[model samples]
Target: MAADIRQLLLAAFEVEHHEHIAAIRGALGSATPDWNDVFRRAHSLKGAARAVDLPAVEAVAHRLETLFERVRNGASALDRDGANAVHLALDRIESYVAGLKDGAGPDMPGDALAALGRYLGLHGLAPEASAPPAASRAPVAAPVAAAPAPKAPPEPAESGAAILRVPGEAVEALARASHDLASTLAAQAPAAEGLARLARLARDLRAGAEVLAAGAETERPELRAFAARLGSFAREAAELSRRQGAATSAIEAAAVRVHAGAERLALVPAETVLGPLARSIRETAREQGREVDLDLQGLDLPVERGTLQALKDPLLHALRNALSHGWQQPELRRAAGKPEALGLGLEVAVRGSRLQVTVSDDGPGPDLTRIEAAARARGLLAPEGPADSETLLRLVFEPGFSTAEAVDTLSGRGYGLSVAADAARQLLGSVRLEPREPAGTALVFSLPLSAARRSLLLVEAGGRTYALPGGVVERLLRLERAGLPLAMGRTILRHGAGDAATSHPVTDLAEILGPVSAAPDPGNPGGAPPDPGILTAVLLRAGGGRLALAVDRLHDVRSLLVLPAPSFGSDPGLVAGTAVLPGDVPVLVLDPEGLAARAAVTSAVVSAGTMAQAPRSTTASRATARATILVVDDSITTRTLEKGILEAAGYRVVVCVDGQDALDRLRAEIEPVDLVLADVEMPRLDGFGLLKALRADGRFARLPTILMTSRGDAEDVARGLDLGADAYLTKQKFDQRQLLDTIGQLL
Candidate 1:
């Protein structure tokens, strides 16, 4: 009896083990796996194995737990070999548990233990070479197969989106709720129609009374008064009927929105759809004897599942292209002063309701000269015509365009980027490649956002109502024309008195949105005339400046879903996208960035006359064309502070995590940097070593280098100077002005 009970417990653990293993495998496939969850799964499996008195399973589970714990603590990483070993262990445990039904089945193999041992050895955390001896013997029982997978919802064709499965019911509740709401709204139509009938009846009664009053030849005051009262009752009843109809229409619109919201609720996060892609590509890289660390960002943003599914293939192609065309040999990477492993990144972000996805890598950026030659050879570019960067870059998307000397596994067919471009077009989006900062190439995709909620300030511009992002609005004000005085043919709103007060130029909404023929105007045709005395203006925070935008009327702020811009008309820069209001009304959502840019342009125009007052000379123009500075520091705070100061002082700045990164940037000539500001102590390479290398090289022998550190010792300062640093600055006695002056002198 005890033996039978033990067998039943073991069988129960088998099901639980399968589930935990599956979940862990899924997590490992993601670009950004939740290590905590992975650890928990492994830990639970170990406990389950121990409860069933399976020593071999328990031993292996404990090792997995150890391995996962190390990963969660960031003490070690799971490379290709480590991942393989984990799978091997899981497989061994599964087979061992499956055979437990047959008494005295077979000896458990030691291969899983040995494999895990080897993997953990890489990080100096190797476990025992063998599992517990008792698990070598398998108990006898009936054959037990794994449970069947539950039915899931419709999923992407690629395995990436199916990393996590959801029960069918997980999707039905919201749809059912939306359907119920729509049904409820439909019931209100009868009441609205009844109200309409009542209004019509009242109107007929009033007409009959009016006819009676007119037919009365004698001067009868009572009859006329009765007719007037009937007319008043008809008007009030009609108003009530109109309001009821509007209310019904509003309810119907709400139903539409409820349905849309429910559908959007089923939208899957980009991470879920793109998660398994990392492991798939990583395995491919391993097969090619190359390695990459892919970082995915903004993948948590939820979007329509179909949209995410559509992106999977193009994004995969882009990543494969990065690996193929941008492959740098280990020796070449070391020579270029970079890490042997490539750092790849895929970032998805929203730009004014437009989905922007980028795939980038830290490798040699595009060789423009080679690209131009390739284009010319392919006859895509005229031999005698100028080959500018833009024109040359565009050729990469050509169907048969390729810069490779020979076809290889990585890139030679030239259809990869072309495929991405075609996919973007099919989705009403666009794709482009640009050289990334500090080296490498980026393929950027700009597509339509299926649905996103945003807080919007709806205002009427040129007779049409549009939405402005509420975050960018400073304040909405109503002022008399006397408050806004004209200055050089421009209206200005001044705040405060004297020097403390600042003035901002004002522009009409009609001017920003162009012509709207429907605008009601007395002074001008096809235009809106500004109010003669009173003005409704929105004080907006725009592009490092302020702009008071004048409008005819201001509407309430609302949170609504923003869709991609409509394709029917020419899309203006100011129109970010569109949002649906009640009654199926579409309102244009304006881009804040575009509004700010326009405000800046208006300000420049308003200040055009002042240009002569302070004339710009050649020297001033040179000064404004900021000199580039490279700041190297391990502390992010220090790097950010220095960058901000330099930028504010009219100098362009680039930052690196440490001395080695700065050296790589310099060696690659990512940018023509005029000065190097480095910390004395940093990981990978210290300030002294960097200065020594720079002095040894003839190219950077006279490069202006500064050593800034908290080490204020005289010996440290002397040592930095001796190593060819132009200046040594101590953080203990730092002064911003003095630092700037020193850099100016060095330059």
Candidate 2:
């Protein structure tokens, strides 16, 4: 527990240090530095470092604090040398903090102290008597050369009451539990109100009895006594009603507070991650011999811990890529009539239900010629035709598809962009590459802002409740059945007029993922008359694609705590997660990308115009043009079974033992394989390895690969897709007809 506390404190210190550095840099750039702000930050850092038992960091922070204080008191003037010294001190502090994170001891090194003393001496501030002499100090302008700090004596562990550090997941779980309880309590509100009403009714009954008794008092003296008793009963009932109402209100308010507090606990400002990210960019740019400037916006936005955690590495990789591949050398940039220092801009905004993060670089945009050449060499593009810009740009995300000529510490192995894309997809988000006009490239990542608290539009489809992210829904349309248009073998809805108008492809939500309902069909009437009833369609936008989902009914929008669905039988692609409703009812949170992909598939199937056609045969004349399939499996039975199916369908096939063997064959074969069918569990390597390897090789980065496994779990499927698989099929659900159809679609 003490160790955990130290870790938490270290993380906090790291964030604070980065923030202070950014502030100091900004302040130094001005006509005058904010001495007070600098001093306060340094003091805070010292306190935090001491709390975490990081003596090295604490010592350096103390020196910085004293220097800043002297400047604040007008005893010393801030100058260029002084500013550089402060920056150098900050760098030392950051390095020690980083070491702490890596499990290093927290004692300040002798050389680091010597360097600090030198910088202080330059500003006419002498070091303490115990400190090393200035004659042994390193240059103030040079980077700090310090050995590891000496280990400090262990202190007595504090009681849990003094400081408690909780894991982020635990906090999230508690928050979710609180939300669920609150929702349950809210659902009982009507019953609570009903109880109050019952009390009111009892009072009314007593009052009625009193009135009856009062009227009869003239006939009988006994009626007068009964009337008084009835009045007393009425007073008691009214009092009970008032007390119950107050109690209910108090309970409801408490629930609300608990839920609110839990939510706040689960969120941290996005700036917490930005500081380190910006620092990393600067460091990487320096290492790469490139001069780049970073501009950041929307750092103050709140982001869930989980989202921020998942984004850190991907963002880092992107920054590295921007510095390494996107920006040219300063001399080259100047020669190209560009600024000596390239500009990398990062902007974060909450768009709808998604957090949109854009990273753009002011450098030469993607080289389509080189991309096309690589794609053709790998058989990804036809040799005879020019590939479109969008298609060429997408190649950058393909594993092992770098345009760089040689491998380097930064990017040459070709996994950087792919990793970024994978991380986005894992979050049920998307990463897109857009070429900037004139010059440069922009990478945009759109992710769900928070899994815990999402504004979901509850919609009923095929008698099942599904939650669609409210942010993705552009607008709701209610149109008569007859108003639907049939185009390209799918139903479409056209909205607006003239240039302002748009047409959206529509599909039934029930038919996409749920059991089919015997509902009236307007798009396909089967020669029957179309229903004249109004139909509701939800228009959704996912990345560059748009689709309208038709549901049986639209329910109320709700803010729900989405929980990950169990791996069993769920499709991560379609089912984003699950959320519990007020009544303990669970609803699937639909992924917009999955829905869009399904819609596209449906449209393509219809447009193919091959529903009634027979399979084409491979004649001698067509043999050379026939598509090739690579069947990889450890089991001979599986391989033979799959090969026979493909060959019988008029395709050539090659068999491999496992992922490793398949990769070797792919690399050695002169002819490119059209697709790979590999099993998940195999010797040497598995299906995921095969997929990743194929993607990592520039030659086959875009090759279609399908994972066939008996595991049939959501995690397995998700993993395969995350590694760049085209499709995932379970053995139990596999059939010759389905396999052929899937293969045809992919090809």
Candidate 3:
């Protein structure tokens, strides 16, 4: 039943979008204008907008609808100016409707919308005798010209009814099924083996709702809206399934309730987003002195209105970046062995409670030398030296930093990337850049989603109620509180000082909650009256890590629906997972490894049982010994990963943060290095220019150099490797093993 409703809603968006397109085209047609189609399309769009309670969209569509009504009734005929005005008005209406369909409609500025309406009124002919379509073939070529048609006051039954009707049962049934499936998966041989099955079922169920909401050709708008709610539920269900653990029961339960709430919110089809972006790319490329073909896959997928709305700016920025920085001229593309016309592709897929969106382009990749020069000139790099490509690439994300030689209004102010990143993060999403294989660049985004709660377990922490997975709990223990000893600082311990057995970490449940826990440990006793202390330590394992967390107390676990994480605030010890409990409280599930790591960092070094024999530490004694490779990058994660891979491959790895550091280390070394594996976009000195500088000096002229940066443009490669570089590899396209393999081959 719910599935039926969802189909109706999905259909409504499709039909509405189609009608808007038709109306815009019909108004722009170069014949005796078909006022009937325009009126019908506008009327349908207005109704659909109102059905979704998109008042902003409804207003624009309503005005357009009214304009067509006068024409249809033979009350007026549009003249040349009126035709232009009508076309412009239709364009605005189409954008507005499309925005609503895509979920980004609410934020459209009132002033802009009103200005379009005013333009229509000023340019339109009053009660004309002969109406004519303008000479322009496309809606974008003309201005808005039409008088404002007044709207009748909305009736409650029609306007308010669309806002009502929530699905309670479907949410409840699916949420329960999700909880049971979660438990079954945990108890089975492999925890993750059956998760995908659950996701598919949930998707199907949600899709059913969409079909219901959208399929009925004559269904009321409110019915279509009811289906939108189901889609939101389906989205949440998929998310919860991804992070299923013992602690998720209550979260699933709470999700049922949240689903009810989410259903009331507006929804949009995924196509709404894909269409405008594709169209804009086609239009923008012509102006940017390039040709681009936009390819969007999975347009039939539905996204929550909120998610779609939040996605607009980021998507737009990414498109602009692709065109401005990624695409090249037809000749250039052909020279690079790519299609003459550059191609930009957008792909969206769901992974657990996360949505993955990718935007990739086939064009000239970034130019590291230019980036290096720009960084040096901007003084972003220290005077000590320029940085490598890796460091320089990172600077592009910094606010107010632009690597472009000339600032264009379209880009290079250095704000878009950061802003887009910020938007995605707000949705508990992250974005990463990968150099396109062979050529160009690709940007990937991941977003968290709300899910249904199946089970819930609560833990007390820092004087408040915290949550954990019931599946994660091995067992709960009770011990007598009096048996524990105290250190000089009054810190409780299992035993006295100097005794390894005596100094067990002691935690009170009360201490965790900032309250006095009177519950005594059942084990320890005999000293005296029990002090006001209680402790509960939860043992958990997650993400290949394990640890015990001290909480105030254990609370009852129950099922509930959960919401998606808002884009900010790291919940302490909380893995990137959430659960729902009663009252729709989102319980952040703890990551045992992440929590234990924090504790491990604070504790004195736990001894590694034994150390592998180290090669004798030598000073700079062998000045011209066997070759050395210098690896430089600011990201410790990247550095570590690279170092491990290099060491495993039997190469001496010297890691540095920037070019200056590399040079310093080299000068200090007893042996002249054999090779340099440097990134071009570093903070100190970049790769291309760094090699040029090193070659300028007499000492390092013959250095076998390989530039490893994220810049993969043909020109960048040709300029660097052609000059002196033995090899060049974009970081995004090169895995550590692959990089090591390349280095081995290069040397």
Candidate 4:
């Protein structure tokens, strides 16, 4: 239990530590540093380190708190040397945490405190403090250099440790990133709560000061100065509280970015992840006294690791099954004038957006007679009816139907082919047993290919919005969740009323994605409404199966690029990647096949908190910064004028060269803002196109948008509004005050 607790603390510390590093780094580099915020971060990090038993980290953090405390108290100024020392300390802490693995983290670098102590002019500080807070506790240990960050996220995986490329660096990068998102398990609620308490206390103190001002004590000049200071303190506290809330959201957004960037490493050759499987097969053959030639092809072709992992099990089963039933003795092969060794081949290829993996063997084709007999004995086929070759071959997949006269290690209680079939079905693919030319058999598994999914189905489950592959969407519909038919302890969604209705087992999307999560979306609520189930639902199809995924809302469908799944928060099985929505929102792109397979595991009517569902969306909009306004125009004059106006109005403004530039910025989310102001007439993707793109994206569909152009035609106004622009303004009759008012109303 103690070990378990220590591990949990390590996990929490991992997240907390990364976030503190980011916060502290930002503060140190800021021209106008938030000294109080820096002090709190150091204090929090110290506590987190102590909890995780990282004495070196705790010791460094303690000295940092003292340094920042003195700075805030005006006892010392933060100069070049001081800042360098702080950065060195942060680097040391990051390096130490990055080296941690499944158990207690790698020992922290020893010189973290020494650097900070040197900056503080402490002669007694040890280079490696063995015991945290050991002013008199223990002797100093030797100094150790800090670890360096990985060059990148990681290369795509190939199985087996010996042959796999540099993965330790990747693991370190992941561990380093594993929750900031060490993508931040953004645990800043306490910070926010602490701010709230501070605000209340300051408010009370200010009230007391005001009372003093109203009394005869106001005559005292010192009392007046004290009152003014109290008023300023209260105001600052209130501002901090508001900013803390936004900071929490910003941290969540940064977590998304870190994880999404990791996707850049997602693409790699199939051999990267499949080499180990092939080697394993070779070893198995040697042990079984079987001689086989492995004909592996198309493995050089690039594919995502997620897709490769899903294919791993079926391929293994298929290869082993070939060894068991498809291999013939060398004597029989010579009589047949065939190769002495069995030809077992695995071939992968892509046809459009579909992927196919064929496992083949040049041996006696499937025994139709044996399969037919098994089917008949098992009552899967009529005993008297003539069985076709196809029917007999497919019957080999029947559970518990085996041709082996006796159960053995190799073949018994037929489950290999069945496993392949189940996997194929789950992938929305099919497993077909076909007779290869000239005495051989091939099992083909076909399914939708995994790539950078551009066409997406936007959906809301719980309170967060997620992106699903548009290809998997069979249809969209609304099913009343209040009174659904029950069968075998499952809620069945019927397409039609009464007996004519087609039944599909209903599974709440939230049940799969988990309890509602995310910061308050300016556009949508954070979770499901008071009513748990919504009328909106999406009917999803994957491979050979279909599922009715009940959801809080069905947002919109758009074509967009996808990034890698977050390492810390998401389930590797469910989330394939993260899609950046318009307005720079990062949403999870769920695996439809995974969802289809989850129907059985997720109780139909259970609470929506069963699975450890990754948080789907973070606050995409920038916090701390003023409400950003994206100004799109081809003319430099128009862009300059609009930018100046918005900036003067207390809005942070970003100008794009044209509609295309604006659209690109929005798509890349380089500038996540609260609203968009664009000129309708521009080169390469007009305002209409931008507006249409924004409306089509679920993230920015409801984003406040305004169309301001020279054109004053009624037709243009009608068209702009039809495209979902919140407001249409014309420069021909432009009023500066009117523009600000309109923007104000929208914001």
Q: Tens digits of per-residue lDDT for model 4 on 1-747? A: 988777666766766776787678667656799999999999999888776767667777888888888898887898755765676577566656655665444555455565576666643334333235646533333344433322211222232222234453473354234323321232344456678889999889888877776786337777778888988998999998998867765655565455444433444567656644554565466457677766778886766666777778778878888878888989999899997878888888874346788899999988888888878888999969687887787787777778878776566768888988888766656789998899888999876564444557677766677877654554465434444433223355545333233455567788877742332332675543734442556666663556778776666556566665676777756776677876888887787767766664554323211001122222321232379889999999999999888788778998898878987788887767888999988889899999888887888878888888876553454456556666666675667876776666555
lDDT score of residue 142 within candidate 1:
17
Q: Could you give candidate 1's per-residue lDDT for residues 551-645 as a string of tens digits?
A: 87666666677777776563456776788887677777777667767655554443211001122354554564488889999999999999989
How do the residues 381-466 of candidate 2 rate in per-residue lDDT, one tens digit apiece? 77887678888887778887777788887878888889999998878678988888778988999876655567677766665667
Output the number of the lDDT-best candidate: 1
Local lDDT at 694 for model 1: 81
Clashing pairs in 4: 158-272, 158-273, 177-182, 178-182, 179-182, 180-184, 181-184, 428-542, 428-543, 463-527
Q: Quantify all predictions' global Cα lDDT against the true fold.
A: 0.70, 0.67, 0.54, 0.67
Residue 295 accuracy (lDDT) in model 4 = 74
Candidate 3 per-residue lDDT over residues 1-747, each given as its tens digit: 765564456446645555575446545554666778778887787677655555555555656665667668876665544444444444444455444433434243343244445544554633221112222321221123323331211111112134344454654455344434433322331233356456677678777777776777786787666667666766776676666633343543454344333332323356555546655554455446565556666655655545766777788788888777875666777777876667788887765336788888887776777777766767888766757766866666666666665788568788878877787767766787667678888888887543334344555544344445443443343333443322211222222112122122333333332332222322222323322443444444433433444554455555544445434564433344666544544556544444544444433222111011122223322332234667877678878877777666666778889878887777777565767878788786777677777777678767767777666553464456434565566665565644544444444
Model 2 TM-score, 2 decimals: 0.53
- Between candidates 1 and 2, the lDDT winner: 1
Of 2 and 4, the candidate ranking higher by TM-score: 2
Candidate 2 segments whose C-alpha is farther than 4 A from its true place: 1-19, 25-36, 43-55, 58-88, 98-176, 217-219, 268-276, 289-291, 296-300, 332-339, 345-347, 437-439, 450-747
Off by over 4 Å in 4: 1-187, 190-226, 235-317, 320-382, 386-394, 398-747
Q: Alpha-carbon error at 114 in model 4, in Å?
A: 62
The alpha-carbon RMSD values of the candidates against the true structure, listed in the order shown, are 22.0, 27.6, 27.0, 24.5
- Per TM-score, the best of the predicted structures is 2
